[model samples]
Target chain A: MTVGLVIVSHSAAIAGGVVELAGQMASEVTIVAAGGTDDDGIGTSFTRVGAAFESADSGDGVIVLCDLGSAVLTAETAWDFLADDARSRVRIVDAPLVEGAVTAAVAANIGGDLDAVEHAAETAWIRAEESVNSGASEAEPVVPTAIDVVTASTVLVNPSGLHARPAAEFVKLAAKFRAAVTVNGTDAKSLLRIMSLGLSVGTSVHLTAEGEDAAEAIPALVALIDSGFGE
Target chain B: MALGTDWALDWLSRTAATIAVQRSHLNTLDREIGDGDHGENLDRGFTAVLTELASFDDDAVPSDVLKRTAMKLISTVGGASGPLLGTAYLKGAAAIVDLPELDGAALVAMLTAARDGVVLRGKAMVGDATMIDAWTPAVDAAARALAEGQSEAEILDAAATAAEEGALATEPIVARKGRASYLGERAIGHRDPGAQSSALLLREAANAAIA
Candidate 1:
């Protein structure tokens, strides 16, 4: 089926970036941007969704990628409005907004099914998470740690480096403790920070965790990174 | 007198059926400016709700029945309407908490609460050309009917008309929420899919209330 890709996010710039990135990976897949506004004031809405479906030659399913809960829900409502044939060909994947959109587009370009696209999107999220976590180790802490000393490390992995999913996972793990953790490469609070790290496989970096659980947190994070961010 | 559980059950069934009947038409409108899945989505959501309703006892209270329906929609429906409509039922049930029968004022309160919940969740308003387009009008109509002390049937009829009009009114406006907003000026001529389906939902509820 012609897999149609829809990216929904709070920012059109981010969605556009994802589409551009995905296009670089896979050229043949149909990718559309929904939600948010460009400087031109273009916003993704039900009208755009209908137009995308109407214009697509491939009856392949449309995979929706949303940035947040509401976007996902809006997409779901839009999806619900489709005809039987159209609905069957529609799939909504809860992927990280920008990175997930790019990954999903690339997967779709490779003629990936819904499952494959979903996996790619998830994978992208993980990669992004690791990158963010590593960056956080470089800067001041956002999540308070239990250890007294902080160490730093780099991610050395083949292929593309830390991205969304990994960064999210890393941050999630860090949030579990009382330590203040921060990612330095970009705005630590931004989800896009990890995606911007652009870490390659096998690259080395520093690791630091300080607080009561800093010792425990450091090793656990190291283990996660060592496992290729569980990719 | 306590409203029989059958009343709620019958209402749920009728609403499902009504939504099913209008699903295709909604899809057609959505196809003009949306993903073209409104028909299938609502059909699927209501179908799931129907299945869940079938499993419930006829003796169930209105709140219980509505709550279960809300939960089922939230779980089974994958998109925005699921949460929006799900919240509607959930909030409506909460509004009428422990009430066996919903009087006119109680129904108004429940619908108003449901409308508020939808607004909070979707963050869209009447002019956004969303489901709110229909829901807002329906709520207003329902309230007016209640204020006028009309019979249940008359109030429901008014609400249904208002909803239908609201849905149709979306055709000329550019969408501001969900997927259609991306189209910018291109979205101006099309009716909003969410509003269309929402009209069907309100109409169904009105019919059920009267029946």
Candidate 2:
């Protein structure tokens, strides 16, 4: 089993919505919501957060994402109350709730362990910032010509391009091989990084892979890109 | 005089009563710069602490009472103050663990530990227009009074007076932390509700010692 996630928000609707959105990309990943006060008010609840931790962790560790100041404080308080052995398995990550949950879910879907999942959640904001910066100015693609690296390019034919679903599919494919791959200068096995590239229909997709399996990883990724991700 | 479990119970009871009476006032102050829920949240926490105190046996020590209060506040406060003040009580309890009573020196150590806990939890320093603004001054005053060989009650009184002055001094500070920071220059001239509550709580501690 992969790492689990707990969304801690001040509002029940926000936690539930994030869980639903992140769940789409990671159907098998355990994502739970702990939101609102015990009285059904709009505040963080200690009981709810503690209970969510128990439900989310199924042998694999749990990553908690909180929204706003009190949510962070309450989550930390709940973390302190956890049993000593279980406490080590829980991480209260400081990241934006929505984006972090989505990226973390995809990482878990790809079979990432606790550290990998936590990094995915923590670095979600960087990818978001990169996407915003990239959106401001489109850059010309650079072709890699290194002898050891295998590279391929293809135009996306799918209507949605490399959106969430397609990005998830692409990431799952890249993770199957032993090669390290990059798509449009971003990690190919990272769903958020690929999605942050903001590839649209008819846009060119450049893939570069290195390692013993580079030759196989490049063609398979290029072929999957050519397949329009089964759109 | 050395303060014991009876004094601790008195301090908690006075704190609960004072917070209940001052709830609306604190809320009004908080509404000027923050979410306006500090009073309600604190009142709920102290109420929970009072209810939990009913279970304490007669032989319970001062640390037991403080530790129970810390847990109640942490679980029931429902705001940033929950963890901030809860950590204060928790660390204070730890400072004088198993001690049957608190002398002037023990009082200073407990206050210092409590203030340090607030600083650690909130990450706010002096003049940040937070509870630390009051707690730091109060702890400093208590430490000074203890060094001068004051009685335990007198040391608590010095802390209470310094905390009151610290809270009043917050009127001129532009908040640099918490929800109040969002107001920028507009937050100036409004006393921080957290500091004010800290002053009130410390005053209760003094009143209990004097009683």
Candidate 3:
């Protein structure tokens, strides 16, 4: 069972619109919107939140993203009413709703478990925060180490270049193996890092891996890039 | 007289009436530091609870009415007050579940649970210029009255008086929680609508007991 997502917001439009935006990145993942009140007013509803939690969970787990203070309060109150099993699997993440939901949806679509999906959503703002809060390098070079290394290079062929969807797909694949992977000197498993590269149709990126699964991961990603990520 | 369904129902009905009468005042207070929806949201919730008030049976426990009110407010209130007050009722109901009557000690415990629930949900403290500012003092007063072996009505009277002082105390403090916190120093000098409303409810509780 894949992890599901629930987006809670005071505005119904925001919740539904966020689902539509994030759904593009995670087509198969279940992203439910529990926004606004029962009357479609600009406030969170306990009934709406409780129902969303029930429907979003498919026995795996559900990650909740809330906007504003009351949204969190309503979600937490709903959580308190859930059964023990549901309570254990459900989590309310403290992060920006839109970005967190999109990244979480991508992680869920790629079959990441509960913790992985939560991490993806929670870390959604890390890059931006680091840049704003601290002047960190945009190009985070992969840490070089003395380990078994496998390398390959490929050229992108997609018309849209490595955007959010493709970058998410690439990171999804890279994170599956037990190895450190990097593309064009940045961590390959990082969706934001890979997307920030702004690689276009003509750009060539070198794929490198170091660890136990380095031998298999490098060639597989090269094949994925060579395949143009199916456009 | 035992504190039972009559007391609980009377408290809720009186609270609804008080909220309706003071609606504009609450809105005026909220307009200074918040979005000006405090009165509207609270009035809507209590009205919704009143609509379903007649459905309860005579043998129902105090928690029965309280839990029902909690669910109604949680669904109808709409905003931060929804969860904060909703949790107060929910936890308050749970605290006195299955009890046929609430004495001074039981009343103190119930108030404590309600205050704790608000604190847990809103994450606000006594000096935050939120409802907790009013609730904490009321709870503490009830606790002290119970320790002093006061009667149930006297305990509730003490709570009501302390809550009034607490709400008034919020006038000069800057808000440290909720939307009001965004106003920073501008929030000072305005009474917190939530704390004001909380004091009103505590007074209604005392009135119910006296009746």
Candidate 4:
């Protein structure tokens, strides 16, 4: 079967970027994109998705790959309207929006069936730990050194509070380490604790690291906090 | 015109239009548990398919008509549905390629091929809170009715009813695929938008086929 691939994203830029990358990787498979404008207007996403499906023919089955939840729904709806034959041929594969689209396209170019394309897309969603660990062995080992314990004071100035975007980032970084990481001023285990602390611009936080990477970890964390959590 | 042969093109045209018309309603239903764009997206995809319908002549073969529509939908629609629906058509067309008329057995073959194509594409089963909820039962019902020497209208009716019931049954399912899957328990209590729309399309096809 001659299959086409559609990549939907929250923004046209991301979708277009994926298509461009896919073109470089595989020129044989047909790839199209449907999505909202770069600024925001998510409302227009449905229309774009429809437009994408409206453009295909009966002999071609389009595989849709979407970025987020809404995109998935939009894609599903589009699939629902297909005629029996069209619906039968159409396949929605949940692949990573950007990377998955490119990989799927390449697989399709090589005459890969729907199963192979989907498999390639799913395999792309590797565990974060696996990704980090893959390169961990390549790093030079730093000598265990002692670092001074210093309290860096900083208040979250964001209107939504520190618990919003900033805390999510902190948690992500913490997950990367093997040390016993704790967010001071509340129950560190509670996501709400660090959020409720409401660390404003002048709030003080004591960051401590006590593992092999403590020397490097503490400094990096302190720098991160000093930078206002990259706000 | 022969009973089965003449009706194939009409069936495809009507089914395409039905999907386009009800696409938005499906999107609204999906909005509750899903991203709420199922109707709108399908409408857009089918609209494009409808526009391409003029390319085929009145005398085009049934498989040729289906094949063209499948290709158009796939190339135009840009999401999971595009490929799923596209593959369905391609497989169905392939199944009935040389048949001048689609008898009850031919219909079963076509449905079976379509279902296989979907399974290969989505990797979803009957209870996945996806379109398979409607498709699986509809296919089964269609096959059973056709095997029992039922008329085209009777078979289509049974298939449509089964599809509608299947779609409604998705209300309490936790989605196993797509964005709704991320919601986990939250996805429960909401009907799958894809399944709902699939029911509508099937219902319309039944009505059109009999008319």
lDDT for each of the candidates? 0.69, 0.90, 0.89, 0.67
Ranking by lDDT: 2, 3, 1, 4
Fnat for each model: 0.14, 0.60, 0.83, 0.06
Worst 10 residues of 4 chain B by lDDT: B1-10
**Top candidate by DockQ:** 3
lDDT of 1 at B208: 70
**Per-residue lDDT of candidate 3, residues A1-231 (tens digit):** 689999999999999999998898788888899988889988898999999999999989999999988899999999998999999999999877877888788889889899999999989888557657644555666655757788777889888889877887888899888888888888887776687678999798888899998989988888888888787
lDDT of 2 by residue, A96-204 (tens): 7888999899889888899989998989888778766866654445455666689888899999988988888889889888877888877787777677778999998
Q: Residue A227's C-alpha lDDT in candidate 3? A: 82
For residue B137, what is the lDDT in candidate 3?
A: 92
Q: List, residue by residue over A77-102, the lDDT tens digit for candidate 1.
A: 55655788888877777566766766
Clash number for each model: 89, 0, 0, 59
Ranked by DockQ, top first: 3, 2, 4, 1
DockQ comparison, 1 vs 2, better candidate: 2
Where is the poorest 10-residue window by lDDT in model 2 chain A? A136-145
Which docking band does candidate 3 fall into? medium
lDDT of 4 by residue, A68-175 (tens): 654675567567656777778677776566656655665566566667666666655642234556644332323324543232334444444454446544543543
Compute DockQ for each candidate against the true complex. 0.08, 0.64, 0.79, 0.15
Give a tens-digit lDDT track for model 3, residues B71-131.
Answer: 9999899989988998999999999999999988789889999999999899898899999
On the 0 to 100 scale, the lDDT of residue A93 in model 2 is 94
Stretches of candidate 3 exceeding 4 Å from the true structure:
A133-135, A138-147, A153-155, B147-150
Q: Which candidate is the best by TM-score?
A: 3
